[model samples]
Target: MPVCFNPLDLLMKNITPRSQIKRGENHSTRDVLLRLFLLLGIFFLLFPLRTVVAAESSGSDQQLIRMSEILRNKEKALQEKELLLREKEKRLAVLQQELQQKEKDIELLRQRAEKVLAEFQALKDEDLSRLVAVFSAMKPVAAAPLLEKLDLPYAVEVILRMQPRKAAKLLSAVNAERAAAISRSITSAKAAVE
Candidate 1:
């Protein structure tokens, strides 16, 4: 294998005087060359140190870039969350509006139902009064058989609406079982009212 000489060594060799070329010959020129080599060796060593420092700086820059990228990703996630929250808020607002509208509609329906119920109750009361007048004109014996054929509740209502003396005569004319049941229903209804 061919031996390779360092370029610095070749330069030193060329600068030496012909008289000092002999091996082990000490001279001022040799000392000067040694000093030059030491200084150049120090410079070469420091050059590698500078390269190491530059590499470290570049590594820090890469870390900064990575950190910045992470921050950007987090910011993007936050923005997406904010958008989702806004969408949810919009949905909630719409739902509230719908709920309010439904409540208004329910209120209107309830009012209408109340009005219809009131009209129906008035009509029922009028019909009951007319029925009472018809029954009151009849003799107790004649009304009693017809009242017995009616539904229990209707018969009881008609009898209760008549004068006390007429209602008593009618009750006496009715079948004992039906009269007793009607009396029980009337008693229970009065008890509930009290």
Candidate 2:
């Protein structure tokens, strides 16, 4: 076999352990410098992004607070409306009760008025009956002359209440027009009764 001499292998064999250690220390110092620069670049790139994200989060929080306030105001308004509705209902109930009481009072007044009217009518009837009796006891000639001086309606009422024969006698003594009016009034009064 022929011997082939290699220069790289011979140099490696001649290198000292102290020189290898010095080379390794230099490579370690470069690695530390590279790692420091990479960390500074990452911090610079991410800082603005972090600031923008924080600003957006603050804006969202303000919007959420405003929405909450609006909801609270709406709830307060609804509660006020409910209270107003209840008050109106109470007022309506009171008004209805007052109206019912007024109706009852009106009915009572009407009943009292009817009773008073009936009592007044009874007194008028009694007075008319007594007047008729007084005129009937008198002589027809005397009664007729007195009746002629009275108002037509009063004379007619007195004549109509007398006995038929006495009424006829008294009427015959009066003027023809007066007797006719009395007869007509009596006929109408009888018709009203029927």
Candidate 3:
């Protein structure tokens, strides 16, 4: 393999005069080159330090002012976050309370529905006479819905208990065959519940 040398090294070697380069009182060329390299190294090493010192000298008060502003901004943001969290918590609490109240309302509605269902279940042919008795006392026009809630026998009893005029009118509105059947059975009917 062939050897290869740097171009700058070859140039330096060719420029040597008087068979040797000599040291001088003022400074040798090598010494000047060394001093230049040292100065360059010192400048490089102190570059960031010089910048910091310059910044400190020119704007230390400004730096402090900026730091305080940043701190205040962070504090405000923290306070806003805290306030938002508290508000959210309050809203959550209100929603929880509303949910609990809704649950209570639902339970009450369920209980009332059960009670109504029980009352409905308790009614049967045995209560026919009692329904008729109540319908007899109530106006026919007003008692229709109550009678309607009852079974066929009870409804017939209630209709028969009405005044002849009203009963005739209601019977006309009612199914003829069913009304006749109820009219025949009502006289012998008694209330019974399941």
Candidate 4:
């Protein structure tokens, strides 16, 4: 192998003194060179400490970035939950409005039905009154036979609407079995009303 010359070894070699009187000058130069090498060695040793500090700072920065990403994801999830809650509230409000409208419609229908029922009752009463008047004009013996031919409930309603004296006279004329059945129906109807 070729011999390699070392620059550091060449710099450390003793210089030739020109004369005995220059010996002290060479010793002073060697001391100065030794101090310079020590300073350069210290600088190189401290360079690795600076690199270690830089690496630790970079690691802290990476940790901060990761924490920030986590916070952002949590914030996004919270926003989504709030949006869902708002949508549910809107749907609940709409359903409540529909329920209220249905209730109003049902109430109106119930009132209309009551009005129609009242009108029908008034017409029935007028008819019953007319029938009673017709029967009152005829003899009880003749009217009783016709009344007995009617359904028991209808016969009882007609008899109950007549004058007490007329109703008693008609009842006396009707067949015993038919009159008893009519009386029973009238009694049941009165009890239900009470």
Candidate 5:
């Protein structure tokens, strides 16, 4: 609540703080001009230094960003190459499986052919001879298809081994022109052999 101030008329005390100076009594036009000149000189000296530091920092940061982008692109290219290799490996596996399956199928076909050939081999020799005899005795045109299924030389031997008259009668039952040709061949073969 107490406020006291000393003016020029106060007891002649010379104690003074520069911050507490009375502006109207102590400041002059020459002092203000000197302070302003000092402030302008300090600002001009520092400005160019600040601008140089800012430019150098910005340039370094741009170089760092370009290096990072190149690294990212390199990583992406490696991933794409690995993907292509994996696809080729998968396709090779499929081809190998198909080749193995084809080999298995071929083995099955060979086994089936062997089984059918064995059944034909099991017929008795005397039974085959009896059948040939019956065909010769009956002298039926139906016998031609069965005889033709046999090897040519074996069929001719079977016919010649039978009675000549019976074998000729069987040939006579076939189509006239075809029978005549077969009869002539058989007679000539028999004569030449004898």
Candidate 6:
């Protein structure tokens, strides 16, 4: 005959017992084996899930730490780049100031050079005028030979500076070829101005 076990009785016996059982003395083998198997089953069923959850938590923590580290590194790199940019801007500002100062100095030098050149040109004009006066005081026959010996452009310039009456007398004394060439140069110069 098969023994009948009630489900309610088994649950009630496992939940609460009347007798106080001593350790390793009056326990049945079946009872001990059943409890051992139950504990093993619980451990097998729950341990892997707990391990999976712990592994996922650990992975997430590591990832968060890596991301934080990456962000910090990026922020540090940006700060360094910004500092370099500021330094470059400061250097650029200094260079621009230097360039402006150099330009000012160049302008002052150019002005000085222009003033010196103007003064030299005034002296040259004064000398030319003095030469014209000396030539005018001379006899045309004497002045013409001296003027003819000068470069053609210089001779033309001296003649143009003289009074028209004095220039005509001097030209009459000059060689015909030189007088004609001087006349041609004067005509061309006037044409160019027009």
True-structure RMSD, every candidate: 8.8, 14.0, 12.6, 10.1, 14.3, 7.8
**Candidate 3 on 1-194: residue-level lDDT in tens?**
88966444543554444346456534467755755665676678679879888888769878889999999999999999999999999999999999999999999999999998888767744465566566666665576555555677556656765677777655655555666776766655644321
Clashing pairs in 4: none
The estimated TM-scores of all candidates read: 0.77, 0.64, 0.37, 0.69, 0.45, 0.73
Residue-level error in angstroms, candidate 6, position 92: 1.5
Per-residue alpha-carbon lDDT of candidate 4 for residues 1-194, written as tens digits (9 for 90 to 100): 99967544554455333364364454566656665775586677568868888888888988999999999999999999999999999999999999999999999999999999999999988988888888878898999889988878778888998899999999999999999999889999999999
Q: By TM-score, highest first, what's the ranking? A: 1, 6, 4, 2, 5, 3
Q: 1-194, model 1: which lDDT tens digit per residue? A: 99866655555555665565677766666667776786788689779989999999999999999999999999999999999999999999999999999999999999999999999999988988998898899988898889888898888789889999889988999989999999998998899899
- Sequence-dependent TM-score of model 3: 0.37
Q: Which number leads on TM-score? A: 1
Cα deviation of 103 in candidate 2 (Å)?
A: 2.0
lDDT of 2: 0.80
Q: Candidate 5 on 40-129: residue-level lDDT in tens?
A: 655775587678877887788778888888898998998999999899999999989999999999899889888877766555445557
lDDT of 5: 0.68
lDDT of model 6, residue 164: 92
Residue pairs clashing in model 2 are: none
Candidate 4 wrongly placed segments (more than 4 Å)? 1-47, 191-194
C-alpha root-mean-square deviation, candidate 6: 7.8
Which pairs clash inside model 5?
none
lDDT of candidate 6 over 8-88, digit per residue (tens) = 455446642436666657777667676766677768867997999999999999999999999999999999999999999
Cα misplacement distance, residue 115 of candidate 6 (Å): 0.5
Error of 1 at 114 (Å): 1.0
TM-score winner, 2 or 6: 6
